[model samples]
Target: MECLLGLLKVKVVRGVNLAICDPLTHSSDPYVVLRLGQQKVKSSIKYHTINPEWNEELTLSITNMMHPVKIELFDHDTFTKDDSMGDAEFCILDFVEIAKRDLSDVPDGTVMKTIHPEKANCFATESHITWKDGKISQDIVLKLRNTETGELVLHLHWVNIPGVAR
Candidate 1:
């Protein structure tokens, strides 16, 4: 099901759970779309059950925008049959702002690092990064299953860098 989130001129921060709790019966896996002016960015995660201590942290980042922004969340139903959004509660745990930097800004000695354990890859998926016209784009996606609840958590991150200091 498609859910429209109207922030109503509210400030958006990373790690904010944009889940719509009222309309959903079961906690649906969430996919988010962020719009900065005409540029749209998207991320998503499949629903996962929380234990006594909720350890779900979906982190996102947006930088260097001087325009209005829009964020929307869609229920990810690709992995399950029961689409009722029940037993689901979501929240934003933390928000941290990062200085906007561009691919051109990365120095010659700069190094990019990612963690992809062999076991993790055997179980989960991997991502790819692209660079073009001095801009960098990455698509990060993960579909994971919680051993305890047998529920799936889908995570996706996408970012585009348009302007890097030359």
Candidate 2:
């Protein structure tokens, strides 16, 4: 069974310094797969590039708030199975909780919450949830765990549905 709570808009902004999966070319044809509970989505494959800019906005219906959004990076291959570059995950409970507050009068770019890199998360650095451009958003840079090198930048937005808990 799967859970469907609400909608969450995940902006897969870009990747930074991704690993070299294709040894022959010394680069990777990369793409990201996002998984939140049972709902899964993937970005388009960027060919022959380590640093891929997806800039794609993916809307995922929140299934379980307790479950973290899992990110898996892979190098697209034609000859064989896609090579797994690395993986990362982020919990959205904190982001959703703060975004639900009264932020109408909040100043733009105001940092509402600060999440640091720790064992509980795959954050590469300190993440700031801000009220930017008349909306609540969080810019998170996740360091790919159990890999040589890679970082994923994502922007998260919580869309509160009518009758849903705000």
Candidate 3:
């Protein structure tokens, strides 16, 4: 038996973050497939209600690929054995390396606090961070020019944990 999966385009900016939505209405489980070059990432979001929504944000960490990463969303029941509904496309953003700050590897005197807002009986907080060289200092705005389009895309904010805690 063969299975057909949806297709989506993923764009990543070296330091910028992007959000992708997976909308599937007629299934009990709606999940998405993220393809980064030869690497494929599957979602863990399952058991969704009708018209389930998944607004997932991913940060650009790897800068070794030249092709656009692909992201495909599908209904779990229809994702296998020729039951796929469809796919969504997003251009994987490009990223630039500026800086890296690991919590356990930080130097000293760097304060980091977490702020989580309660919504729908759930706690939400920013958990992802991609350090860059630009920072707003002395009430001055800082920006980085995109080499491709001469556009300045800030890696706005980080809001997602990196991996499972040991």
Against the reference, the lDDT scores of all candidates come to 0.32, 0.87, 0.31
| Candidate structures ordered by lDDT, highest first | 2, 1, 3
Report the error of model 1 at residue 46, Å. Answer: 2.1
lDDT of 2: 0.87
Model 3 lDDT, residue 126, Cα: 33
lDDT of candidate 3 vs native?
0.31
- Model 2, 1-166: lDDT tens per residue? 5545568899999999999988899899999999986779999999989999999999888766777899999999999999998999999887777766778888888998899999878999999988888777888999998789999999988777777655
- Residue lDDT tens for model 3, 116-154: 333321112232223323321011011212211111111
TM-score of each: 0.27, 0.91, 0.35
> Which stretches in model 3 have alpha-carbon errors above 4 Å?
1-28, 48-50, 55-61, 78-82, 93-166
> Per-residue lDDT tens digits of candidate 1, residues 1-166?
3222211121122222333332545343554454554556555354541211222334334342333333444455655542322222111111001122334756543323332424423113343333334433333322222211222223322333344321
* TM match of model 3 to true structure: 0.35
Clashing pairs in 1: 25-85, 25-86, 26-84, 26-85, 26-86, 45-154, 46-153, 46-154
Give the distance in Å from residue 90's predicted Cα in candidate 2 to where it truly belongs: 0.6
